[model samples]
Target: MGRKAKFNEGVIVRKGPGKKAKKTERSNFSKKLDSQHQKHRARKRLQKIKERQDKQKLLSEKKKKLDRIQRKELSKKQTEEESEVESEEDESEEIKILPSKGYSDDNKLWLKPKQKWIVQNENINDDESDDNGEGDSDTEDDHDDVNNEVEDEEEESDDDIEMENGKEELDDEEDSNLKVENLNDLSDDDSDDQDEFDSENEKSDKDVDDLLPIEKQNIKLKKKQAKDQKLADEEMQLNIANQEVFQFPIKESEEEIQSLQDVQQRIREVIAVLTDFKKLRDKTHSRSEYLDILKKDLCTYYSYNEYLMEKFMQLFPHSELLEFLEASEVQRPLTIRTNSLKTRRRDLAQALINRGVNLDPIGKWSKVGLVVYSSQVPMGATPEYLAGHYIIQGASSLLPVMALAPQENERILDMSAAPGGKASHIAAVMKNTGVLFANDINKDRIKAVVGNFHRLGVVNSVITCMDGRKYPDVLKGFDRALLDAPCTGTGVVAKDQSVKTSKDQQDIQRCYNLQRQLLLATIDCVNAKSATGGYIVYSTCSVLPEENEWVIDFALKKRNVKLVDTGLEFGTEGFTSYRQFRFHPTMKLTRRFYPHTHNMDGFFVAKLKKFSNLIPKSADHDEVTEENVENEKK
Candidate 1:
């Protein structure tokens, strides 16, 4: 038999595995019942949640519908009211009558018809017509006739009222005349009373005035006596103070006074030592000592870099260096160039002198140049300047165009032209006959060129806005070109003092590279040996050798161009050697102006001649080779 199971309190029991199996089945059945109950509860909860959501959605939609219906009703009511008001206004206009001539008389009291009664009657008629569509036209006509008769009667009544008012006015006039007569009599009596009162007041016032003078004299005497007594007391006190001071004079401490005197003497001596160059030189006594003295002097006296002093010493001798330092410290005079296109230099000069402006010729190089010594009026805003009779330009800036020497009927390019100072000068030199391509990179700056071109009456010029270095890609074969490349502006420090510290070595390198590119592009754009002797003028307002000679040196190696003489007689030759850098030997042909020597801002100008048969390198061959490689890959 299978294993038997014993029961604790029952009479019979099943034993072992079967009994345990039975118990497990019972437990599983109970668990399934519990699971079913839980599932039913969950389903009921979900249904309740869904019902609540549906109710909320229905409520919201109903509210929105109600709001829309209310808005429509309100709008309809407003429209109906507006229509009613419009109809009432129309009815009133139809029935309204103009005022009669009798009512218009000034003596008559006019009565205006009450518009409210007319409006109320019209409204009642409109309501009655709405209740019954058919209305009696004859009745309306009769009512209008009655109204007209009433108006006629009212006009007659107004006429009678005006007649009565006229009579009343006549009576009032008569009464006013009598009243005026009585008022005149009363006024005469009042005048007599006032005369007597005035006479009595005048007598009283005369007595008071006669006594016031004596009283005033007595007060004046008292004030004078008090002032004299006060002055005498002050004089006596001053005398006593003076006597006390004379008896016992103030004494300064001898040591402190002597120390102060010594301090003043030492200050005077130090000032003398600092000012006297001979004393300073004697103290130094040698080349190294003098070098140290110059470094300190440049720093303290000029507020300049010691490096600049060293470089200047290398360029100039000791005797000349002092003169250069002195020259750089002074202010430069204002210089202007007369526009020969509009007026002669002599005539402009005379006109300026008549207006109290002192003038002097700048140099023998430019005949139209004038240096303004003094002026009572603003030179720039003068009638002559506004009329474009002259261009305000630096004397140094005129050198490049003079070196270019563009002739009439020849095409020329002024690269980097802005504010058109030099470009306009070129046009003037060309006599406005040639096609001068005035180009600038900045769009805003180009507007200035256009304005100046128009002002100066330059008809042969065409303005183009483009980079100077990119001129080679778009333009070619110019008779002449002026590339006034941008630079560090160190040469114009006297005019712009901020330039002294605005740039550094890195800035010089950047300017040098840009000038090189622009110079190369300018050479490529201009013809080398045209019938009119094509040439390119490269210029900068920089004093640095890197931007001047070094740029030329680099271009000479890369291009088939030769540096030629700029034919500027006033400036010195360019430096072939600067520090460790040695430039091309032909760089000496270029011109460099120094402020100390030339009495102008330092400038550099190099004239270049391109070879006649020269050609630029091509990039087509590389492109073709790349295409072949791609075909092979395919």
Candidate 2:
């Protein structure tokens, strides 16, 4: 305590020295304040740096958004360009390229020519018996015509013709030498007055817009200018065409052409099946009876008798087939094939029942077929369709598969299996147990076949995309085969109008060759073994003899295939034999369902069986004779 008191009171230094020490302490404190101020300044600089970064970030974000919008616009433009290119490509691809298949290429179907009989006016010469009488008759006819023409010209000269017959008559006969020179001056005065009145009326209408502002006035002025220009153009046309219209002599052929049109209109009035070539050749009926029957049937089904008559005349231009078509009874109880691929027959029937579609099952020696009545509900849009349970097929389409009668566990080939209607049916007939090689030349149609198989729950099918002619090489020997040869679907003309537009003899011939080749390929697939040898069904939707019988005959000679009796109720026995079947549009209980007949699509189906070991020993070896080689070289 004593040392502390001495330090506080007695250990005092000199005043000057204490003052120097205090100054030093104050200098240190001032140095500390300077460092604190420097630190605050650094913190302020850091804050300014952070603020500048944030501002830059905001600008970058705005720029990014603008860039995104520009990119979207650019992308949209690119997409439009791509779509345009794709559209052009699609348009180009729409034109079908003919395949190199020799069959279809040779058997191209052609349209029936517009047959015109040259009228060989048989004026018996006999040095022309009684030439004076003929000459006098001709002169008298000319005199009568000239007199009538002169009278007509006089009638036209009378101004009363216009008053009596109206403006249309005056215009029609403007070429007649009526001599209206006196009326021209009056017509010109009337035209000038009309133009002046129209201009005055236009000016009066403009007053309503005169009070408007300049912009509005300008808009109105543009519209008025457009209207006035159009009026002036029309007036100019009228002034230039003031001359009278001309007339020409009425032609005899013109009258005939008009008559044909009238006949067509009359035929449309009848609603009968007008195309039954087979019936036309029948010897049992009279021509008048045929015509009356056809007329009656047309009247029964269609409302337009005139149209039916016209079509009848056009179809039977020479009246050779008219009697036959008229007499032939239109088929009853139309047959509709069940698309087994999409749906089952039983299921479709039930669905139809639910939809109030009256369907009656056709019986005896047939697979699934039906007689369905009309309905307000569209059958195509039914739930059964969406479920892939059924396809609206033709009874004739069912014929080939039924004829083949595919057995379980057999390998079969279907050439040209597009739309898979028949392919799926064949699978069904095989009880979904056999291996099916279904092929089509068209790749786009492949999807349809696959879809059909999927819907049908088919498991034993392998779809291939290739021309049917090449199928023999790809798929070797099959147990059974079906070649629904591509023909000019003449049998189905009743359903599609476009088919008729392209129908011709040349087209049928092309189809014939294609059918023959397809049949040959199908025959190759047929096995010549087992107790019941394999069968091949060669079919077409064609009615031409060349495409049908001629093709079958050729195949018979080439492949030694025997025709099997179809035992159908509708068609007459085939022209060649009972083993072959023919279904005419006019026949009863057959599958050639014409609109005028059963109100159904036209179709044809033929079934043939391949005998075991039927191929001759010589067939195994090449028989290229010198003559044949020469012919080939030629």
Candidate 3:
């Protein structure tokens, strides 16, 4: 402000102590220009840096995505390889290893000579022929050729004999000129020959007479009987071939020894012959033959699908797998649990026995459970069953309620209760004094639940058709809860063979998810604290580890629960690990009933105790989020 500005020749200068100073207006303008340039440079630099950062970020994200995809592909490849290895191992284990020897020819039962029975039809007219005879001429020609060849040879021999006799007569006449003796001999010979010819003609006439229509019909009936007999003999041979066990022959030279591949080939050939499945590619084969081939090709011991067989071998040892295969081939014994509320065990046993039902007590663990070894009448239609004195139930289905141990005057909940076997058992155990809520998601199945409950004289049970997973929100404080969750039914394959092919790995995963939901809901519904601690019994009619131990593992993490021993000593311990999955160590306390080991359906039962009343935080958040979304939509 104190210095005045002056300009000269497009330049301005001011006097100062040290040197010429520029004018304030010009200097200020130049400074402003410089500051603007600096700011522009800084903005460009910042923009370049930002662009570099964005490019790097994009590259990083792309690399991360590629890594994820690669990881997934690697894992999938590993899983496939592992599964292949496991299957190979299972096959090597299950298929009986042939010794250094070849298959035995000891009995040669499978090599029985084919027998062809020819039923001679004496009444068949040589002149008669049916219209279809042209098409079947090959078969008929075979018979005609045999008969004509024998008759032609016999006629030629008889002519030669006659020629020889004529020569002998001529020689006798020439040597001895005794006309009377010769004449008498010729007459006798001619008479004898005439008699023989007459007898032959009479027999031929009789045979022709037997060729009438009625006689021909009788001959055809005999042929039919002969054909049936041949078939019966063939069937008997096949049965013997199947029953006779043979061993492989040992060879001194190891180089010529039969390997597993050769043994498998031999087995396949034997099975094909036994089952009459010779032409697998034949389109005209029956369904039964096709099914036999499919079963034989799938496994050496069982008719299970490849996946199921592999899983079974993975789950059990070779000996147990054999037992399981044998057990699955036979029907499970019909078992009944007496309704204690309706009849006592002793009385029901006596009543059933009187009704021609052979009953054997199941075990010392259950007084009311009876294994029906034989029943003359339909056990389900019997008067005792109709009167609710007893209810037909699988031995495995009774384990959950036995583990539950419901008391009188206590509230119990059965989640996913349909066809109410376990629920009825629970009610009977409670002596019909407690309130039992039996719930199912399906309305149609609920009808069955109601029917079974009514038939079993279950008075305290209340049926509801609703999703069991929603029960924790609407109902609470049940003294005990049973979640016999719906599963793939791998356990009851003995009863329902279709289960072998009806389910797959995806179905198991779906069941696993549903079971987890139902289990969590059951935990919430049961009382947390009681005089007698509240219990939740989780059961599944499946032998799959994903549905049993893995589900328990998930519940242990998500819910405030702990597993306890079910006090059942009949079954083996639960699986602690399967494949890549590892379960809690305490899961061993759960019980696994195998059909081969326990003489029951494959079943899994886990008894859990809830010590905390706290609700899961995730559930609350989920509910809140759902409410907010609904409100916003409205």
TM-score of each: 0.51, 0.45, 0.52
Q: In model 2, which regions exceed 4 Å deviation?
A: 1-348, 362-367, 567-569, 577-600, 612-634
Cα RMSD of all models vs. native, in order, equals: 39.2, 37.6, 41.5
**Stretches of candidate 3 exceeding 4 Å from the true structure:** 1-301, 616-634
lDDT of 1 by residue, 359-408 (tens): 98897888889999999999989998899999888988899999998899
Better of 1 and 2 by TM-score: 1
Question: Candidate 3: which pairs clash?
Answer: none
Instruction: Give the number of the best model, judged by lDDT.
Output: 3
The better candidate by TM-score, 2 or 3, is: 3
Q: Give the TM-score of candidate 2.
A: 0.45
Q: Which window of 10 residues has the lowest lDDT sum in candidate 3?
A: 107-116
The global C-alpha lDDT for each of the candidates, from Candidate 1 onward, is: 0.67, 0.55, 0.68
Q: Taking the tens digit of each residue's C-alpha lDDT, what string does model 3 give over 532-615?
A: 658999999899888899889988887889999898867888878887778899988999987777778889999999989886
Whole-model lDDT for model 2 versus the true structure? 0.55
